[model samples]
Target: MHQEGTRLPNEPVLKQKHKKRPIKTLFLEADEDHVAYQDSTNRFMKLVYVHEGYDLTQPRHQLINPHYFTGNYPGTDNEELWTEVLDYIDANYQPEQVYLSGDGAKWIKNGAAFIPHCTFILDRFHLRKYCKRAAVGIAGLDRTLYQWVLPGQMKFIRDYFTVRFNDLTVTASQLQSLKQAEKYLTNNVSAIKDNGLTAYHGCSAEGHISHYLSRRLSSRPLGWSSAGAQGVARTRIFQLNGGNITRFLQAEQRQASKQAKVTKLDRRLHFK
Candidate 1:
């Protein structure tokens, strides 16, 4: 009821509207909660999404309800959060291969390892983000190869920059920047042009974050406790996934009324 915006478009709907369709692949995305707190302790929270059935061949899927987990939880590996992500996909979507693309964090890499049949594609959005920072070293090739960059031509670009760099007599700093840029690109060459690697092209995390989470939670000035934060997140995600809040409340009331009747019957029998 306290939602900020007036225009929440329940517009784009998932393909498997009725019957379940086996997912060919899925994309995993994790984002941080900027204002996470546990009673003013300044704790951290992560919002992770497991979305499937979005490939270049087909229409993109709607936002699947996300899984929210608190960071620094007890009794788990570092990959605990992502492990849960894999589990969520297994239970619901049953995709054949999960195409993972996200931050190049150790934990994210480890998540791909967790899934046996997972293909790790360095999401172009994140890859280009780092590329931009390191691009200064590559003679600002990002500007020159603007179109090529999106099409997954980083290897060609890298080779061109290599030759260009060797010819130029530059300062150590410039050389270091070039080397850094080259290494970053070289390491992620396979992930470049991921659309060729898989039917689905890019990571939709940025857009989803804006539409689902940030627009309501972070962009506004609302504060939340650990429970409150997680609650709103789960609620909003469910709404995005086509859940009706009114029907949900009615169902809860019905269940509560049924439980009360059962309790009264048990008490009457005991008294008799």
Candidate 2:
């Protein structure tokens, strides 16, 4: 197999662009996996997928024509990644509005710059996670707090936390959890409220990362070199995207044979 020197396999490219068409609503989910390297450091393989929407008719909800992009797209700013997603969207579908859902990571939120008429939504999983953390040991308050989140009643929750810390006795660890939850909620209050207002099909980026990335990349007790991990990720994506490995290898072999002949001919001419 021909491998690029210490680099990932080329990023996946569509052989032929999808026929242009109009789509009313589109869903995008972005997330990353923390992959451990043999050198004891970690790298992130970012993932983003675009789908028309979910199909409720199936017993298990399925995405309609989902296209996935995965790689160690190095950088804190995800403009390049989002630009690819935007280009795919523009080529395939004329979407009136695009809804991007995630855990409100800055990188995920940065997608707004590239995706026009986009709305950012905080996934319920993270919202519930922090809400439960904030209301830890407050008997039924977690449920209440979640309901409050739906209506954007964050101030009440904040005031309740303030009162608890000031008037009530709490362990240092418990106070830390509360503080963390408060900070998360405060930072993403708008996203939380947007979740309530928008017609959201819940974000499954976490589940997708588990299925697509974790199972192959980081599930077992194994470490990989940066290039090896990236290569595996790109292969996994190719397989997931329905690429035929046998046909691909045959094509590569043919191309390699042709390149070899060209190089041989050039060497003969130089020697003469």
* Best by the TM-score measure: 2
Model 2, span 105-196: residue lDDT tens: 88888896569989888899889999899887687788888998767897897788888788567888889998898888888888888876
lDDT of each: 0.59, 0.81
Enumerate residue pairs that collide in model 2. none
Candidate with maximal lDDT: 2
User: Please, what are the lDDT tens digits per residue for candidate 1 over residues 39-85?
Assistant: 55543345556664344444665444443332322222356666656
State the number of backbone clashes in model 1.
0
lDDT accuracy of residue 133 in candidate 2: 94
Of candidate 1, the 10-residue stretch with the lowest lDDT total is 4-13
Name the 10 consecutive residues with the lowest summed lDDT in model 2: 1-10
